[model samples]
Target chain A: MTAAALSLSKIVAGHDGHVSISDVTLAVPAGARVAVIGANGAGKSTLLKTIAGELPPLGGQMRRCATCARMGYLPQSATVDTRFPVSVYEFVAMGVWNHVGLFRRLGPAVRQRIDAALDRTGLAALARRPIGALSGGQLQRARFARLMLQDAALLLLDEPFAGVDRPTREALMALIDGWHAEGRTCLVVLHDLDLVRQRFEWCLSVDDGHAQLTPTAELLALRPTADGAAAARHAFLRDALRA
Target chain B: MSWLLDPFDFAFMRGALAACVALSLGAAPVGVFMLLRRMSLMGDAISHAILPGAALGYLAAGLSLGAMTLGGVAAGVLVALAAGLVARRSALREDASLAAFYLISLAIGVLLVSLKSRNIDLLHVLFGSVLSLDRDALLLIAGIATASLFGLAALYRPLVIECADPDYLRQAGGPGALVHLGFLLLAVLNLVAGFHALGTLMAVGIMVLPAASARLLCERLDSMLALAVGNALAGSIGGLLLSYHLDVPAGPAVVLSLGLIYVVVLAFTALRPRPILTSEVTA
Candidate 1:
């Protein structure tokens, strides 16, 4: 009933003369943590891509808030090589690239934003390291750091926890929770339905090219939160950085 | 060292040296990027396709160097365009088009030479008798070599990105087509200048070997070019002297020298522990 922060109307997307996902429509209100769940290839990825403007929707319209200056989309795989000769700070600074054209210097406010992004993502200490040397978890965190810098009200993440360790996954989810507390809307495509139920308040399940809305409590019935209290140390470091 | 000086006493030896230097320096960076982009084999294909063009140019204007070089460049560009077209239009892959173009060009070149000039100089075409390089050829190749470096400097950023991932450029709304065209044109120019000293097949080898060797040694794009250019210069000079003493073909000698450098550097890289590991840059 609320004005959706993001809306997609009759989206059709495909490859090579066949539709991968078609007739998909959805809307999300502000500050909603929406999870797209499906068995593989339910067009969950395609739907996210179409929404992010990475792929042109074959026959539909999609809209995001004009005031949403910060929009973050993390793809299923890393977009660029961390191996290329660039540093983490330089790499995250690139997230602000659309904000600053190539040839302009980063003034202090921009500098502060970048420093904050790194610190929020728990990457402040590793800022000086070359990107290529980072571990998988660290690399994902660095990318997350960049998204935080964008400060967008809408976030689209395609399987952020895939291939990460369980503890690292929990840490990342905690960070996402922190972002949610800040009142930013998020749409994350995820496989782990347990985390979907426990952390996310809303769920959209996709099957056979169609998605059905499900209550967050129903998904939570399968696996409730294991530890009621968050990991004390991880939460402390995360919260302390906010001050 | 004395033997190197002895060869320099002859004017033909000096011409041979000049051709070697021109081909080596000019073609190395072009070759470096080509190899980096997984298009090293394409370099071989482009050079082969230039032969018939050179042959046709000779047929039209006799043995005039300009006509031959111009014809070769036009043909090379045509081959590049054709390969691009074929890849885009059909499911036929890039390697397939490259192979087809090179084979067709080689056959046509042979047939054209046989038809137009029965007395086509084998020495001039194959081994690259650098002794035959005229003052005008020297000036032209030198000019082309200079242009190649300047062009590289100007287009460095776009070309690097193109090699790394063209999809990024497409997303950025930049003119991906223009970048592709510019690189093909640069390739044609390099091949044209390379035609003088290394002829067709060997000239590409002259360009590619040094670049490949440099790639193995350097960790970054800038360092790779620097090493490649330096390696090319060294290969040219060393090959020139070796050819003079052994009375061999200058082009093949230069290519062999470059090949030797690649093998040596590869061995060195294999022997050394990876340096970037212990020096892990934490970000």
Candidate 2:
């Protein structure tokens, strides 16, 4: 049996006095592939942010394994500064920073790992080139290479496929599928339902401030909500509160 | 060559040149990180905020570089701490707090300078004199620059990663926050070190322009830092020579040289071939 990677008990998180997401309880068993889906501002990103430790939960106890350093997070495309002057190789090498710390040199094994990561992501050919010099599809590939090097037990991706071309997208999904095959857990925040089911094994549908463990089949069975997600989460929260 | 050759003939000119070279070398890489962290304005704020300390140093031990520099570094660090606190505590924005820092420091500096020195001496304080520099200043600047270089060489990756992506850094459970504040402290200390040659206003350019120009040309952080340090050294030397030959002020001259370097970088990058991929971002 796989260990649990993340467990949040009755967590409440928000900013500026208003709770964005509250009273959410979820446990992501290690190696489980889960997708979070909802309309905009269903607290999907907020929840992800809190879980990623970018922001602390406003309420509740959140606990994790002490060796949880093997966790990877890819923020939304907008939050990243895509204009830094780094080569594809240099950028991907950064995935080892947690282990590197300050004032340490990368050993040959680590270099080999970085090389393997880039190759795994289908970015080996692009290693020598400038990161800024890559096309949208190519850049995403480079970022994915970094993710691979993290050797993370769990992967959290926020819109990884955004702006990527078609062939490259397939390649990326294949790479993720490969990770899933290796028994690593992944929680991907994706926009496409077709890709979600085709690639993911579990679904976490969030509406209003609440998310549920609906089987992937059920979310696929129930169509995307009407009146958008912000309202949907509210209505869903109201119903859950009454129940 | 004569411009370089003639400067060594005079001890003060030699001292100014050596000090400027050293200060620029260290400040260049520090500036690169400063630009990456979006604290270019903060660099300026710290430089100016150190004025009262420099003034206090002069008041205590007379116009000795040792006393004044220590005082200045202390004051600059205090202002940075204050700015950090104010931005966190008050509704005022970071830039606004920096502005408050600038005003208060400037006022205190003016009051101190008025209490002792004449107006031209204060002018020399704001804008350094080629004639007043000595071998002691040169050695001090050299020591500071060398130490900064060694520190930067050791910490470049962590620093670059801190600026490039803080989210992953936090998830990775590294000391991302402390490292970030350390980077800010580096900026303050570097600015205080460069305060004499570059002055407060022009010091930031000496720190920022070379890095900015290098950014246009390079695709890697290490290479960019290397190029920036080279650019700063070359630019300051060029400024010193031109100012010496043309009889212009040295501080403005050094900055003008960096400005001209940026213009050249802009033009060259426009004409140069970029990497084949579409978007280039650092990690």
Candidate 3:
């Protein structure tokens, strides 16, 4: 088996110390495209944030292996204030921050990389436009272009496709495929089971305060059956109260 | 041309003009960032917070510009840091904590001035004596402006990211919160510098009014900054001339000129709306 890119050991993660997901111990192998899926409010974002270091895990340890040098995180779109007066190209170039950092001029090579990323994401034509002028789909495309320039070893995406149109979603997914082929690990929080099954090799299902990681097919098979749905609901309520 | 050129012939009028222009160069850009971050009123809060320190400085050194400036910067920064800490550590929101701190500072500042200084000195401290700016005050104002311009340039990229998409900056390992704190410090520094010319009560008006007016006329950030500085210059020159010719107080006259510009910009935009009003509705 390939070495793990990231691993969580008996983790309890949540927002502001409120335990939303607990007892999640999983090893995400390098270059794995893992789909994180669950019911609404099942701590998918919480888990990704813990991994992205946005929020500390309440209980356990999360370790990135030697190969995982950098992490790129795409938060939910609502968190961004797009009206703050930056051009699309300028916004996309921000992804180079990890390498160039504060005060380092962007060399010609970095500029070329940014241009290529924008072209690949279909944002080159809109590069001079302010970020606020872009439609929802175009904004998502711009974000993907920025992510491409991040050049990180591991990627964490939180509901990247939430408000995106179908074409933009497919384009973003294709970008994800490109990243995976480049040997980058991706932990994507998604609601579309069809897309998850079609694209993802690994799955992490967060449910009722527990997170289970397995192969996509196996996890889908193990989902609550129609007859067990009611019992699962009752158990979820019990867990929620306990939490 | 003579009416305009006549004002510069007098050394004190020239000095007041230089002080106002220098103040505009520094404080206007800081105001633009604050406006972008939706912290326009925070400028007001910090201005009020500068009062007690200036009063304390007056009580100690008796109207020495350097002493008052040092005291004002310290007080503004202290109030900002204290409010930020309270908001983070406790349940009180930043606005509430800032309000509480600034109110107390304002009250203490007034009491301090009334206790020791003559009524005329209190008037000078509150409204400022722009026409009476000496060489030392001019040097201090010019020096602060130079430092502020350089500081804004250095902090530009991170400050933009912190304002636009702070979460992305944080996740990208760019120290967003620290950048924000640094920005607040810059703003406090500029406010202290501004208080020397415009007085604590009206210092923020010079910063905020021009920036707010500029926002109405431009969609691009650079354009907005240029327009804001331009507006501040025009208002400074116009208000100084108004004070000289009409025998009015210079600080209020300067701020009123800025306010008039804002009203004119507002009226112009209202009559002929732009196709792209980027500041209108945001994500």
Candidate 4:
């Protein structure tokens, strides 16, 4: 078996010392496509944030392979202020910052790389247009173009397809498929269960501060029916009150 | 031609024009970021907060440039830090905290100025004597403009990323907080530079108006920056000429000229009905 890309032991994660997800223990193997799925406020994003190093684990241990140097993170679209006067190319070129940094010159090679990424993400034509001019789907495409430039080993995508159009969604998924084929590790936070079941091999379900990592097939089989969902909610309330 | 050429005949008018132009080069670019970040009021807040420190410096050294600038920068930075902390730690928002702090600072500054100096001297502090700018003041203004322009160029990338998407910058290993603080320091430095030429009351006006007007005129950041600098220089020169010819305060004249430009652009843009290409993403 390939070496584990990420190892988490009894991890608790959240912001400002408040635990959002507790006891999350899992080992994501190399090239694994893992979907993090949960209801609202179920700590799905919090878990991804921890894995992406945006938030510290409130408790527990986590490790990644030393080779996983470049980790690309696509935060929720709400985090970006689109009104800022930046062109699509300029916004996407920011991904090269890890390599070129602040002071280094962006030579012809770097420019070509940025152009390639923009072309791949279907944003080549909009390269000179301001980012604020792009629609929701186009904006998401621009962000993906940026991530493509990053070329990270581990990709953490938070709602990458959220609010995107069908064509854009398919294009983004194709990009992810390409990444997975390249043996990259992907931890995706997704709301569309159908898409997750079809695309992902592993599923991590978070609910009421508890997380369970299981195979996608097994989790889909165990998914609650309408009556079961209600019962589950009741049990969840009981467990919470008892805690 | 003589109407324009006549102002340079008087050395003081030339000094005033030079001072205004130098102040614009630094403050206008800083104003671009300020407008983009929706921190326009922060400039006003920092300018007001600098008053107490300027007053204290005046009390200690009596019209010494270095002493007053140091005090103003120290006070502006302190208030910015405090206001940031208060906003983060408490229920009040950043704007509210900044407003509260600046009001108290302004009151204290006015009180301190009144304690030792007459109203006329206080007026000089409140509204700068641009025409009477000495050699030291001219040097300070030029130095600040050079430093600020260099700093802005160096920090351009990180500052833009920080303003647009701070979380992404942080996650990508960019120093977001440091960029923010660096920008704040530049803002304070430029405000101090402006204070020397335009006074605390009118300094932010020259920075904000030109940038805001530039925003209406340009869609790209680079274009906006260029236009803002151009507008600032034009406004300053125009205001100097207006002040020389009409016997008005140079600082307010400069600001009013900028406002007039903005109003004209606003009217022109309205008449043409240009399609606004930018659309803000709903958070």
Model 3 C-alpha lDDT per residue in residues B1-283, reported as the tens digit of each score: 8888898899989889889989889889889999999887778888988989988888899878877888888899888888878989999988898788878988998899898888887777777778888999889888888888998888888888778787888888887777887788889888887787888788888788999999888768899999889998898888998888888999999989999999998999899945753334432
Residue A12 in model 4: lDDT: 96
TM-score of chain B of 2: 0.90
Best by DockQ: 4
| Worst ten in a row by lDDT for model 3 chain A | A222-231
Candidate ordering by lDDT (highest first): 4, 3, 2, 1
Reference-based TM-score of each model: 0.79, 0.87, 0.93, 0.94
Write the candidate numbers in order of decreasing DockQ: 4, 3, 2, 1
Q: Decide which is better by TM-score, 2 or 3.
A: 3
Docking class of 3: acceptable
Over A95-140, each residue of candidate 2 has an lDDT whose tens digit, in order, gives 8877665567889999999989888887888888766577778777
- Per-residue lDDT tens digits for candidate 1, residues A162-192, read 8787777877898789889998988899877
Give DockQ: model 1. 0.14
What's the lDDT for all of these models?
Answer: 0.75, 0.77, 0.84, 0.86
Candidate 4 Cα deviation (angstroms), residue B226 = 0.8
Tens-place lDDT per residue, model 2, B112-174, is 977998998788777666446666766776877887777777667777766666565666667
CAPRI band for model 2 = acceptable
Better of 2 and 4 by DockQ: 4
Residue runs of model 2 more than 4 Å from their true location after superposition = A1-3, A65-69, A217-243, B1-3, B84-97, B267-283
lDDT tens readout by residue for model 3, A85-187: 7889988998888789888899999999999999999888888888888887788888888888989999989889998778889989999999999999999
**Model 3 segments more than 4 A misplaced:** A220-243, B88-93, B276-283
- Judged by whole-model lDDT over C-alpha atoms, candidate 2 comes out at 0.77
